[model samples]
Each structure stands twice: as C-alpha cells, then as structure tokens.
Target: MKDGGINFISFSVGRYGVLKTFSEQDMESLLAAYLKEHPDALERMHFVMLHPFRDDDDEMSRSAREIHHVAKRMKFFQDYVARNPYDSTILINNPTPRSKLYLDFVHYVAALLGPIGSYEIFK
Candidate 1:
C-alpha cells in the first residue's frame, strides 16, 4: 500500500460475531509496526465495525452475556484507536447492508478520497 501511495486503510473487526480472535496487545503491536514503517498512514486508518451479531442459539446462551461480549469488543476497538499516534476514524456499521459487500464500499471510499480516488475490482 505504501508503495502504491495509498494512505488510507479500512478494516472491519468481526464480520460474523464479536469473538476474540486476537488479543488487543497483539493487534496493537502489529499495527504499531506497520505504522512505524509508514508513519504517514496513521491518520488515514479507519476501523470499521461491521455486522455485529450474537449467536444466541449456540455460542452465547444468555442475552446478557451476548450484550456484554459485544460491548467488550467495542471497547477493544475504542482503546485500539485511542492508542494510535494519529487520530483515526471509527465507522460503526451495525447490521451491515448487503450493498456494502458489493459497490457501496468502493463508492464510500471514492467519496472520501474525492475525484482523485478510484478502485477496480480484480477477478
């Protein structure tokens, strides 16, 4: 991305449910290293919260526990963004729209970058 002169990076944490896959420290360390390599990209990073859900029938039996789990994950994101050297944006896209999987993300990103931004999907 740095080689391509792309400064912005958008990442969604959990697409299915709020499950802890990586520890906060692990993610922070990884991001810190990448940021160190491309210091200018720090302010352009965006962490998206997409499709936050709870598997009530199986994984999480209690509604209270599910809510707590989601809350904890959200806090994790908040803390992660807060620790960054540059102010980053957090886009909470709860109940993710189907269009987002299609062309919406491209359009959104294009809009953010204005007329100069362009994206092409590779098959």
Candidate 2:
C-alpha cells in the first residue's frame, strides 16, 4: 500500500530490556542495509525507542542492567546517524509506571507516519 502522502520508514531495532539481543552495531548495519534498499526513504525514517518495563522482581534487576547498556550504546548510535547520509529522528524515552509514554508514542507514530500507516506500524 502507498504510505499516505509521505513515504515513512519505521523500524524497531531493539526490544525492551533485551540488551544483548541486538547490539548497536547490529542496528547500524541493519539500517545501512535498509537504506541501500530504500535509498529515497531515509528522510522520513522514524527510529522508535521503547521504554523498558520494570517490574518489582527479578526482571527489574535485569531491566536495570539492560538499560545501563542501552544508555551507553545510544551515544554511538546517535553519532553514526549524525554522520550518515540520512535525515532521521531518534526518540529516546524512559517510561515510568504512571507515565503516558505509550499514548505519546502512539501519537508520534500517527503524526509522523500518518493515520493509515500509523495503525499498521502500531500493530
């Protein structure tokens, strides 16, 4: 389907609290490959960063550790994106239990990707 009026490219490169699952290098390589395939779509690319869900159990500890690693890795990602031949935006977020970040994230996708495309991406 046509992506509304704008050609929006949305990619989720990492999972919540899964630090080792995909390193920053892997994400950079993935984006590079994607850019090679869709050369004209880099200007509207949206890289969304999901907030890690922290529970009051063992998972909380894991989440803390993972977030620490992610904090460090994000700097490299930012540098690469800046030097690369693409105009993209990175949304960095830390969701608290009472925060409405999900709603904000949804709105961001809708605004950036358009209504029709946002629904598909939100799923």
Candidate 3:
C-alpha cells in the first residue's frame, strides 16, 4: 500500500492497558513498522506511565500494581528507551485526580496520540 498523497498511521507509546495482552513479538512488529514508516518518529515517539494513579486495582482500572507489567516483561520497551533520540518528559499525574484537571490532561494526551474524529481508548 502506498501513501497515495495521504498521511496515515502514527504511534506514541503509552500505558499498555489492553496492549498488555499483546505478545512481545507482536509489539516488535508494530514498533518495527512504525519506525520503518516514520524514520523521524523517535523525535515524536513517547512512552507515558502513571506512577501512583493505577486505578486498575479492585478492578478500578486494572490495579496500578501491574501498571508496568508489560513493559517490564518486554525487552523492546528497554530498547526504545535506550534509543530515544528526542527530548520527551514523563507526565506526573496526581495520584488523586481532580475531575476538570484530569479531564484536561486526558484530552491533552489524546491529542498528542493523534486520534481521528473519535477514538476508543481501551476495551
């Protein structure tokens, strides 16, 4: 498939959420494709994680306990970090979210992820 004068596809890593289910090989293929398509992607690529906002516990959001399980298990995560050529900062989301503020933050991140008219977050 060719671009056909259309710009499509982008990837900026974030909390795995459902992606935690993806096998390491699957992730490798995805990153490989992204990098191949966007040689300059490292300049815009990112990986975000919330330290204490893990609402996944008690089934809240999947329990913050495993917030980084996938990244830790996957060696590719480390490779990305090591080869990152851009200057990206890690967001420090408040452990206790403030509604408006939290929503704003969510919106800001959604924009950075480059969603279309609408996008589904996670299952």
Candidate 4:
C-alpha cells in the first residue's frame, strides 16, 4: 500500500517453507546487496519480514529461531543505516500463524509497512 507517499509490499517468507532454508547470513547478505545496489532503496522501502508458524514444532522452536534470525538481520540493518545517515531504513516484525494460511500474514505485513495505501502480496 502507498499512502501519502509510502509504497508497501507484502511478501511471505515461510509459506512454502522457503524461510526454513534462509540462513541468517543469507538474509544479511541480501539486505546488504539490496542497499548497495539501490542506494536509495532503503529510503523508499519498509521491509517487513513475516514468518508463519506451521505445526507444533513450528509453534515452538522453528518460530522462535526465525524470530531470532530476523532480529539479527534487523541489527545488521540498523547498524548499516546508522553508518549511512542519508538512508532511511525501517524493519518491522510481523510473525503470524500459518493457521490463517496467508491472509493473516498479509495483514501483518501491511501493518509493519505502515501508512501505505496499496499493497501486493507475494508468496
């Protein structure tokens, strides 16, 4: 959603279990590369990492692990943004349960990327 001047995009991470494959290092490298390539991308993008719980194991360990990984990624992003003062970086958490399938996940993602008038849900 893009409201006033913000464009939001809702992307799912754990829908097909792809997030389970993403190591914390992979996330860090991706963010770093994204920032480096676009330079101004951070200023325009508000990234919302979403992890949807699957079953019992997901509810307990997997979800916690994913959150921890995301937290670390956010720390790296925050540090980078601090070093590059000109860039605007926003990272928000919106971990939901896969029980809602993907709808709840989309809503959570939208909330993270706030003040947006339009949004696209990418699975």
Candidate 5:
C-alpha cells in the first residue's frame, strides 16, 4: 500500500500492537546478522553503495547513485519514517517543502543526466 508519495517497507509492531520504527541499532543488528550468515557482506555492501559511477548506464552505477540520494535524504527522511515507519499518510510534522525542493533538485539532476525511476521530461 503506497502512502504519501514514497514506497515503504512493511512496519514491524511491538507489544500492544504499536508499530516499531527502524532504528540505528536495529539496522546494525540486521547487518550483523546478515554478516553472520554471509561473512563477505561488508564487501558486497561496499560494492553496491560506494562503487564508482560508470559512464555507461548500468544497474551497478545506478544502484550506487540511488544509495547516495537515499542516504542524503535520510537526514530528513529518517525522521519522517520514524514517525510511523510504514505509515505514508500526511504527518502532523510534515517536511513537504524540503521534500518538494529535493524533488525539484532530482528533476534538475535528471535533466542534466537522464531520466530515473520512470520520470519523463515535460518539455
């Protein structure tokens, strides 16, 4: 179920049916668990998240850029996600302006480079 204007992962609930928000600790724990299962997960993560951009269009370079933008937006987005995690409804504390600006910046970048994630140029 899409909410707001972004896709979200499913939310986990705590005791008494309260939804659980993603936390740094939880992310770390999940990473640790994944590393426990796959010892080379750190290298894999670096390959995806920190790999250099390529001149040609490729999934790997696109993945890296996506991760970069996602990390950049996380500064404001993490708070929004923490509000309800999976809830996409309008928030009491909305960062709509920031989000709008960010979207515009994305479009600017897209025009400079190329379309991303189904965006089409208006003119």
Candidate 6:
C-alpha cells in the first residue's frame, strides 16, 4: 500500500544458482507479466533486486564490476521513474548466512543502507 508517496515492493529471488541478466527492458517485461497474472502487483509495483555476494579475494577484485552493475540498475530504475514518477525505495538483503560468526554481513549491509541509530548490539 502507498502512503505519503512512498511505495514498497517486496520480492524474493530464490537460491536456484542461475544468474539472470537484469536490464531495463527485462524489468519492464517482468512487471508487465506479473501484473497480468496478479493484478494486485500493479498497486505496489516498485522493484527490488536481490542477489548473493560471496566473500572471497575475487569478490574484492570485482568491486569495479559490481559498481558498474549497480550503476546500470540505478539508471534503469531512474529512467522508469522518469516515465512514471512515483516515490519508491529499494531494500536489498543478502539472505545468506556467513560461515563464521565473525563475518557479520548483516552489519555491513545495514551500514551501507545508513544509520541504524541506537539499536542494541548483542553478542
């Protein structure tokens, strides 16, 4: 539901291991098809893209590539918003557990999203 111009779209990408290429046309097509099948989707049509990130030395090496990928996705959504300007927010979650408790990826994601002010830190 939309309130004060903010619209939330919630979706989950299951762990099937097939990397799908994301593009503006692809997103539009997906939304169109989804709306056709489930009309209610049209009401909360903001897009959220979720993908896994594995921590490896190679992952650090590909920082530039990931930056480009994010830029392209942002541009695609920006263009979509231009045609249909609506308040939208993107919430990305990793949904993958770390092998070791020391590797708190959730904290990293939260920091990237912005301040989590005064949230209790538990051990």
The per-prediction CA RMSD against the true structure, in angstroms, equals 17.1, 15.9, 15.5, 15.5, 16.3, 17.5
lDDT at position 50, candidate 6: 26
The positional error of residue 111 in candidate 2, measured at the CA in angstroms, is 18
Local accuracy of candidate 6 as per-residue lDDT tens digits, 46-116: 11112133334454334323333333344543454454433235335422111111122222223323332
**Which prediction has more favorable TM-score, 4 or 6?**
4
Residue 77 CA displacement from its true place in model 3, Å: 0.9
Measured by lDDT, the strongest candidate is 5
For residues 54-115, write the lDDT of model 3, one tens digit per residue.
Answer: 44334423212222333444455445444432233544632221222223333333444443
lDDT of 5 by residue, 1-123 (tens): 248978565554432122223333443343344445556534443443344464334653443344334444444345544553433486665444334323333333234223233323232
lDDT of 1 at 68: 32
User: What does candidate 5 score on TM?
Assistant: 0.28
1 versus 2: better TM-score goes to: 1
When 1 and 6 are scored with lDDT, the better candidate is 1
- Where model 1 places Cα greater than 4 Å from the true spot, the runs are 1-19, 46-123
Q: Deviation in angstroms for 110 in model 2?
A: 16
Instruction: Point to the candidate with the largest TM-score.
Output: 5
Between 5 and 6, whose TM-score is larger?
5
Per-residue lDDT tens digits of candidate 1, residues 23-94?
Answer: 434344433443455453322322111212433233222322332333334444445344432322545533
For each candidate, what is the lDDT? 0.33, 0.35, 0.35, 0.38, 0.40, 0.32
For residues 1-123, could you state the per-residue lDDT of candidate 4 as single tens digits? 235676545444542223322333545454455445445433333331333233344343443343344434454445533443431244444322222222332234344344554435221
TM-score of each: 0.23, 0.22, 0.24, 0.24, 0.28, 0.22
lDDT of 1: 0.33
Compare candidates 3 and 4 on lDDT and give the better one: 4
What range of 10 consecutive residues in model 1 has the weakest lDDT sum? 43-52
**lDDT per residue, candidate 2, 95-122, as tens digits?**
3311222232223333434433242333
Kindly report which residue stretches of model 4 are placed more than 4 angstroms away from their true locations once superposed: 1-18, 47-123
Residue pairs in clash, model 1? none
What's the number of clashes in each of the models?
0, 0, 5, 6, 0, 0
